[model samples]
Target: MNVKSINILMIDDDAINLKLTEVMLKKHANVNEIIKASNGLDALGVLDKRGDIDLILLDIVMPVMNGLEFLSNVYSKNSNFNIPIVVLTTDETVKKEAMSRGANGFIAKPIAEQALIQEISKLIDLG
Candidate 1:
């Protein structure tokens, strides 16, 4: 996939995870830009400010709004923003639930760089 122009939004409460993912994605995906948010509310703010995001990597547990609630809000919102979201979590048990709630893909935490690249590439290419 030609991911050179893809802008990604990463929502996670852990600063280390966000930084690590950003670095890994930069190296592996050659992504255009990555916007980081500590929580879903902050993610929405970033979205409002920058509407060109192509994909979202979201965490399930967060302070303000969890990933599920964020997904609900995004779909329910009046805007026609149809960006694909990939749920990033440590709990593999929620994989089915996350997909059912609108996640385009799922990735367990302590993310493997290659796996993340492959998964994201598929989604971006398909979209």
Candidate 2:
């Protein structure tokens, strides 16, 4: 996959986590843009407004709406929601459920730069 640009939507309630992940992506990946959302509902709104988002990095637990709910909403509302989503979480238990729900990948929290890059690479070209 030879993508000309890559836009990522990172959904996490924790501001620190979001910032850390964004910094890591900027340093290690060939990302062009990074959009942020505090929760699933916010993410939905972002998705509605932006068609350029190529991928989503999601957190499982949140206040307004969690990652699993976000997956359900996206898949249920739009059958053609083809954007690949990678769930980022500290909990290992949700792996099976998240994958079943429609997540393309899963990365344990305190995200390792190399692992995050590899997971994103599998879903979409970082370039």
Candidate 3:
């Protein structure tokens, strides 16, 4: 797939996670723009912005609001809610709950670059 056609929205409170993810993805993924959110609440604010985000990489635990709370708000919103969400977390229990709450899948962090790439590739039609 062409690396300029796909866009990803990544949300994490940790600066390192965000930076690592972008760097890992930049080489192969067609990244239009990466919107960074410090917490789940901040992530929600980006939905209104016009951009080419296809999938969301969401973190489970954060300071302002957690991933679950963010998912709940997302599903409840009237906006286009069909965007695929992959939960990235350090907690196994939280991953299970996130899947139950309508997450497409869960990826544990500190994310392995190869596995994360494969997972995201499967979720999005990257052509």
lDDT of each: 0.86, 0.93, 0.82
Better of 2 and 3 by lDDT: 2
Per-residue CA lDDT of model 3 for 6-46, tens digit only, reads: 67788898899999989988777466677788887888788
TM-score of 2: 0.94
Residue clash pairs of candidate 1: none
Q: Name the 10 consecutive residues with the lowest summed lDDT in model 2.
A: 23-32
Q: Which candidate is the best by TM-score?
A: 2
Clashing pairs in 2: none
Clashes by residue pair, model 3: 3-30
Query: What TM-score against the true fold does each predicted structure earn?
Result: 0.90, 0.94, 0.90
lDDT of 1: 0.86
* Model 1 weakest 10-residue run by lDDT: 73-82
- Flag the better candidate by TM-score, 2 or 3: 2
Shift in Å, residue 49, candidate 1: 2.1
Candidate 2 — what's its lDDT?
0.93
Full ranking by TM-score: 2, 3, 1
Error of 3 at 73 (Å): 0.5
